[model samples]
Target: MENKTIILTGGGTAGHVSLNQAIIPELEKLGFRVEYIGSKEGIENELIRESHPEITYHAISSGKLRRYFSMKNFTDPFRVGAGLTQALNIIRKVKPAAIFSKGGFVSVPVAMAGRLAGVPVIIHESDVTPGLANKLAIPFADHIFTVFKETMGHVPKEKSTCTGSVIRSELLDGSAASGKELCHFDNNHKVLMVMGGSQGSALINEAVRENLDRLTKQFNIIHLCGKGNIDERLEGHEQYCQFEYVTHELPHLLHLTDLVVSRAGSNSIFEFLALKKPMLLIPLSKQKSRGDQILNANLFKSQGFAHVLEEEQLDAHSFLAAIEQLAAEEEQLIHAMTEAEPPKTAYEMAKLVAAHAK
Candidate 1:
């Protein structure tokens, strides 16, 4: 029990890092020293270093794991090899009891290093189907945790388990008034929050902006427009608030929101489900991704937790119509969310890790 240190790794996107962020404080409370290994420039470094200053953060070289052909494909292996060496060196110094990975490209090397270092590597997969990194890291993982039960079929059955969703406790503690004050938004109109994931979707941003005048008439807006995606023209617009991204402020924003229009990332949708927000989902198309968002969105739609709008059919008019439809179904969606399974708290999930740790 003396070596209660644990190493957490993930990055590239917010989805890959959320579960790790959620469990960090609980891990600390359980007396584990949490050290993180992430890519030098990935969002994970900014998030963990800024939000959890007590945790030691390590930067390692990592390459993107792309499905399509890219010139980087030829050079990424050398970068990955360097990352493995870095991760193993870190593992040797920390001698963590367990290494938990959320399955991003950076995690592949970390998981491999953990196996070589004889550390128990536990991975959490948030999509219906595994991501490319998780698929590659599965062999190195001692156990894989999934948010979707269907994912069990994609990984080694004996080594994987469905733990359902894990939500951060602070996300549920937000005050609506505090959120309203933060945005300077009056309660005259209901608030609608639009998120296009951590990277922001240009398609979603354009549609929302083109229709902003129409939408602002009915609702106040909080737009998480993604990094470098904010339009300078919209800076002083009344009833519209835009941010490149948010970290700790997200919970308050969610508390202030009455409706949501967002990408169908599992972590985000599950957070909406926990908050009982009526949502209109715009999933990333198969052309853009592995179509994991399409599956995540459709599942929520079937459960009555969301209204799905495919990219092909989305336009200025359809975007407004979907918002109207979501508003009309608000009560029903809330009821459905009420009946759904609640998410695990950070402490409970941390305990799960401790139970399985080497």
Candidate 2:
């Protein structure tokens, strides 16, 4: 007999996609057919649809749930309502055994609909501070998963499990080395892997661009410029590689790299930590509603695994200094990261979700 089918939702950013990337293969190994419900606007829609053409996919409308006062807030509930109806229709048609939510605004509607249908729903929150989507779905979820232990108190403890963040195999194996070589790095040079989440950070791009000559002189550079901005940032860089995205080659870059300078999104941070790479975390504190990035950076930094620099305080000089310090002390940073592991989480999470779906 075929294993029960499950519907997975959540992904507006690489962080959310990172979770799915970690567990999708495991679910397949356990004989579960996983389907996805995500927004067409998110990176997931195109990436998942193209990469896993065989899997079932349902595109749905979604809106962000703003924490600050905004006109968008007034319309989010209506969108959620509509998404719920779309999700219910998907549930009825697919009759999935369960729904797994990675907890973003994109997953809210599907989770709500799953609850109303008496279908068991599971959610995973990546940051120490739960996002608005996860918070809204908390009361309805049958099982909740988290990356950080500090997040336990924020959710219903009985339903919550601390399964460290789900990291893809490429990161686990340190395969990002080739990405560095391809980027024209010399063997003796230190490499700083710069990424600004999935959408790409204009601030980060500008900072890196401003300090490129200095950065290139000291360390090898591989920049994942967000979509459509690579050309703008790469105007005259003949020595370094610039990419809009690098899904397949990230592990190689992660391996061959000496340090990482990335946005403090849970997805990127966990992947870096799993790779045991030292990082200079630049949190997007300017974003009023989503303070999760700031909180994540602080938690990891307090533990001495990485350095946190708030976006406002970050400048070319400060960034360059931080990179120099981290590059010099990479060994200590690597050791600190290795000691922070809570557990082997993805397999356990898969087992739990599989049991429920069955």
Model 2, total clashes: 9
After superposition of all CA atoms, the RMSD between model 2 and the true structure is: 2.1
Candidate 2 is scored at a TM of: 0.93
**lDDT by residue for model 2 (39-155), tens:** 878888887877677788898888887657899888877877788899899988888889999877889889988988888999888888788878888888999888888999898
Off by over 4 Å in 1: none
Choose the strongest candidate by TM-score: 1
**Candidate 1: worst 10 consecutive residues by lDDT?**
179-188
Worst 10 residues of 2 by lDDT: 168-177
The sequence of per-residue lDDT tens digits that candidate 1 reaches over residues 1-358 is 5698999999998888888988998999988889999999998998888888888999999999888999999999999999999999999999999999998899999999999999999999999999899999999999988999888888999988899998989999988888787788855799999999898989899989989999999999999999999999989777999999988788999999999999999999999999999999999999999999999999999988999999988888899899988888899999999999989988999999988786
**Top candidate when judged by lDDT against the true structure:** 1
* TM-score on alpha carbons, each prediction: 0.97, 0.93
